[model samples]
Target chain A: MEHYNMNLTLKVWKQKNTNASGSFEIYQVKDISSEMSFLEMFDVLNEQLILEGKEPIAFDHDCREGICGMCSMYINGRAHGPWEKNTTCQLHMRAFKDGDTIVVEPWRSKAFPVIKDLMVNRSAFDRIIQAGGYISVNTGNAQDANALPIDKKNADDAFMAAACIGCGACVAACKNSSAMLFVSAKVSQLALLPQGQPERESRVLNMVAQMDKEAFGNCTNTYACEAECPKGISVSNIARLNREYLSASLSTEE
Target chain B: MGLTGLFLVTFLIVHAGVNACIFINDGGATFNAAAHFMSHNWVIRIMEIGLFAGLIAHILQGLLLWKQNTAARPTKYAMSAANENSKWYSRSMGILGSLLLIFLVIHISKFFVGTKVAMYADGGANDASHNLYLEMKEEFQKWWVVLIYSLGVISLFWHLLHGFQSAFQTLGINHKRYTPLIKTIGVGYTFIICLLFLLMPIAFYFGWIQ
Candidate 1:
């Protein structure tokens, strides 16, 4: 594809820390290549700020290819960008044109507090995972791929659910700030497999309890999370999550 | 909320069906008899208690859920393109539900109270004395009353449009084959129920039906 260069304006949110209030700060960047990823554009802007003896803007990123789930940016009112099933780092600047003005902000959720300019502490997700997003079985060695027979449909669905990168996009996109999509994807990833069967009940129950404890909003099934997810995570996983949660709650001896 | 909401959904069918009796155009005879039977039957009376309980539960649960959902976002976004992702009615259930609650209060006061008062005055026996059909005609003759009723039905239409499928999804009843089906049925249900309800007010107001 042919690449072109463009100049653009950016309006970015700046916060000193978790306790500090944030505001939009505008800046102009020149000769930005359309081939550059959205984060690279930010890098150019940050370099400009440094040259001007100004503080560089801070944002999150790790595996720039999009698998790490570390990058989280609400660009132009979208969790990642305007692109469907795209992450912030993977969002090409080609989506915009010359003289475009892009606005960026960190994910806003009560459960994910702002740590600095464009990074929010996502340890709440870590805490939720700790709550029971794992299996108890201690398999000392790798098993043969064919050792456990799995249904083709369940395997496909499980693979799809496992594609979720645990990005905060679901929470960011939700009107209620709900993490149900992320939680449900995680739940469905395991719930469909025999390996996940043993801990399935406890996993859903504990994780949901921890999720509720995290001050995340409840799911109203508005389904914005599915629409905005970079992985294109399906909302049907949320149905499975609800099913697992309800079944577990019902049969629990406690 | 889903369970209670579906209960109310069923009640809407019964409500719209009974009210549609007015279309019989038999000088209120068929309509008042059905209304009288609904009010005076003992089994129906007990079911009415359950209906009220379910409605109150749905309302209270909805309010509490709305409160928690609101508190989830302590800081609002400076810019939101939420409409890019979801429909407005799905996200605005709280406001729609509040509007519906206001309409419901007006409805109960206008027809329910009058019908009950007329019954109690007539020794709580099965009586055609209340002339509820005439009352509806006269009450709807007021342009404001018809306007409010129209607005209520419209609000109810939107609520059901999202809610019918939503209740099933909440109950963990979603399926690839069935979710689409439920959505189609939900739209059809909304239109039919709301039209059935809207027909009465517009018909009475315009004197299209006796």
Candidate 2:
């Protein structure tokens, strides 16, 4: 692949802390290689900032790969830049031109407030998960993996739903800042499995209550969460979540 | 919201079907007969009560949901650009629904209230002589009324375009094979239903029907 070096301008969000008023700070970096990942480019800029005795931009990132869900940059009005189904860390510099002025900010949602520059406190997700997102089993030695004899379709569906990494991109992308997709993905994964049957009724109810308590918006069925999901999580999981919630709410005997 | 939305969808079809009776060009006789039947039949009358209740519940729930959604994001983004992520109508249901609510009030007053008044004056539902078709004709003759009705139908068109498939999705009827079919049916349904409703006033104003 052919590579080119480009000088670019970045307008990044800067704040001392969550309570501080924030603003965009523009920094020009010369000779940015097109082959570098988006975060690598940020690394180059940070190195320059530190050498000049300035505080570098603070952004959340663990794996340079897309799996960790730690990276949460909203670039140029998108959750993860211009590419579809691409994470911020996975976004390459090639997507931008030499003279591009990229504006980078943190995920904007009430449930995921900014902690610092381009880093939001996503612990609400952990709370939502803690509410129900687990299965209870009796204490025993490990059973054979094939003992369950799960249906192939159900297994595949569960696998797909399980792929959610708890990224807040779905909330960032939604007009209402809804977390339905993330909650639904978790709900659907458990709902499809036989192991998740014991607490099935209470599980959905508890998780959804937690989600509501966190002040995340209701799903408007816009499907934006699915579109921006780096894991390509389907909105059908949300449909499943709705199904679960409605059934749990309506059932009197359970 | 999903349950009531589906109910309203069914109601729209029956309502549109009755309105399509205007296209028969029978000088409003067929339309009046259908309207009278709808008002007089016990089952239909009972369903009408349910329909009204459903509509009220739907509206109240929608408002509450909108309030919660708005409060969820206390702070707005400096640069949203939300249209890049979702359809305009999907994000604007509150506005579209409010428009429809205004239209509904005008519509029910013109026909439903008139029918009730005539029924009471005649001392029974069997003897009520109000001609709703005539009221529609007179109303459509006013350009502003027709314009308002047109705008309402336009809003209905956009609302149905988003609501139909969304209702199904919320109900968990989504499937790889059936989803595309549902979406196609949704598109066709929206166009046909809105066009049928739109034709009523246009036909009255243009003298296509008596």
Candidate 3:
């Protein structure tokens, strides 16, 4: 790609802490290379702020390779910039033109409260996973990898569903702020595997109850969650989740 | 919501079949025959109760989901291109459902309740039970009523456009090969049913049918 420089203005959301009322603060950055990742541009702006003895903008990021899912922000109305199936860390300045004013904000959900600036507390996701997102098994000798023959289709689907990074993008993209996509991904992943069958019924029931308890909205089948997912997780997982939930609820009944 | 929605879809097909009898153009004769069968048959009557239960359940589920969804996002985003993310009809189910609900109330009050009343109170020689075809005819004669029915059909069209495939997907009936087929069938189903419904009011009001 040809390299070029651009000057731009960013409208960044600013907050002192969780209790403080947040607002947007405008800042300018000049001579940004088009090939630079969006976070690099932010780094440039922060470096300038440090030189001026002003507090730098705080944002969450690690493993800037888009796999960590730590760089969560809504760029110009999208969950992770303008790219499809990409996290914010993968977004490059080339996506924008010179003189463009970009708006940035943290994920807006009651379940995820802003900690400071663009960083929000996503530990709610951890609690949901802790509720019942895993399979429990006896600690014994390691079983052979091929002990159970798995169908290729089922294995592929299980792999796909397991790709969810718990980035909270699905919730942010949803009009209802629903976490169904994330939860469904987890549910379908386990439900599709033979090893996960032991706790299938209780797993779905417990995880869904936990998701609802977490203050997330119900899925309305908007398809936005699938669209905005960085891992390209399909809404079919949600369908599977619903089916699992229904059957589990029935089978558990006396 | 998916189960109830699929039940209602089946009900619509049965309803459209019965209503299509009006196209015989025999001055409400065939339509009244079908209408009488639907209203008087004990089995049909029992199924009607189940249909009502399904409809009520679907409506209740929709309302509850809407409330929970709204509560999920207590704060609005500073800037959002929500339209860019999802289709308008997919996001506006609540508003569309509300419109359909109002239309349903008027429709049930006009025909279903009228039929029940007529069934109880016989009007001399004119069997009120079989007079549903006439009731529909007279109702469609009013221009405003025709407009309301047309709007209701319009809402139904959009609702089914999303709900049909969505119901199957929610039920986990989706597959790469079959999903496209279901979607096509859904589109065709929505167009045909809504068009048939729309044509009924237009045909009555335009003197195309007495």
Candidate 4:
């Protein structure tokens, strides 16, 4: 209901491509509305960059809504900015003071290499999901959703796991650079449901193997992933993942 | 670490029961016979092999896991900050586990491997129950040995407090509803096991209830 103008200084990362050595370039922005979303503030900065005949900072964005999760930024040492359970795009300028210094950088991971200024290649996540995520279901064999009769508690848990948007924020926030939370959420989502029964063994085995191959670190339970997750995905999902992986490993059938 | 860790949990229960025999009938024939069975039985020899295997696996896995953990965060944080969110034991598990591993090497080398070597060298002097008991008593008489064992047990207790529930959680035996209970069991089991084990050497050293 209220708007206030603010002045901010940013030390932003600028990279030509994945192979290029990047450095921080400083920029100053004045008279920005407090209600502007973090991305909108970036929009204002980019507008200034274009007017000065400089290349506008290249960053990823699509829906601008948090659901798409295209926006990624490590702001002031915190992934996805300073807010809890909110993505960079959803973060408002109001969260900061009138005069503040914001340090913006791309997600740092060998697997997620820098594509440009603030965009990194997150295709590692795609490969992890592709390894084994869905069960092969025939289109013609339509059955009632209630036919399986999943327990209410299990169903709720499954839905919670499914909330993950594959944002890569968990990986960014982790101190060990672990993707256990993401991989676990994906694994737990299906493991809790009857539809996932057929491919359960292979799904866990393949996904975990893929995760390891991606050079993701083992979880040390720092819980920074949960703290930074926009969807509020829990670290408990990783515990379930460990269980599933061990069970799959022990199963004689597979 | 999985199989070895679970085996160690089992070992804790059995080891506690064996040590509890010291209090049974106040060091009469019953306690001596239990100690004799543990020392001389063929079945226990097989179990000792299993125990050694468990210890090796646990240590190797811990080392591998710690290596991977370090690789993940290759860069140190520029600033010092306390993680107010996580449990202290969870954060310090690596350090505590390393200390426990060091203690394990010393413990097994001194008591386990030492007893075996001494038994073979003396041509059965170390085999008899009364002799074995005297050897143990003599070992405990060293104040430095007692101190080291005390520190080892304290570190072990800390390690178990986190490890017990963590293994269960990793195995997926934990749920939101049951997690609290598992945590309680973890802490309680660690306290009891360490208390019981530490009491034996201290009791022997102080000449309290030997």
Tens-place lDDT per residue, model 1, A97-166, is 9999988999999999999999999998989989988888787899998999999999999999999899
lDDT of 4 by residue, A131-211 (tens): 997888876777887877999988988999999998888888776678999999999999999989999999999999999
B-chain TM-score, candidate 4: 0.88
Question: Which segments of model 2 are wrong by more than 4 Å?
Answer: A138-143, A250-254, B121-129
Which of the two, 3 or 4, has more TM-score? Answer: 3
Say what the interface RMSD of candidate 2 is. Answer: 1.2
True contacts kept of 4: 0.35
User: Positional deviation of B72 in candidate 2, in angstroms?
Assistant: 1.3
Every model: iRMSD = 0.7, 1.2, 1.1, 2.8
RMSD (CA, Å), candidate 2 to true, equals 2.3
**B12 Cα displacement, candidate 2 (Å):** 1.0
Residues A77-160 of candidate 2 have per-residue lDDT tens digits of 889888998898899999998998988888888888889999999999999889999998785988898998899999999999
DockQ of 4: 0.30
What's the lDDT for all of these models?
0.92, 0.90, 0.90, 0.81
Candidate 3 residue-wise lDDT, B179-206, digit = tens: 9999999999999999899999899999
For candidate 1, write residues B30-103 as lDDT tens digits: 88889989998999999999999999999999989999999999998888999898999999888899999999
Query: Any residue pairs clashing in model 4, and if so which?
Result: none
C-alpha lDDT of residue A111 in model 2: 89
What is the DockQ score of candidate 2, to 2 decimals? 0.65
Best by TM-score: 1
Q: Candidate 1: where is the Cα deviation over 4 Å?
A: B122-128
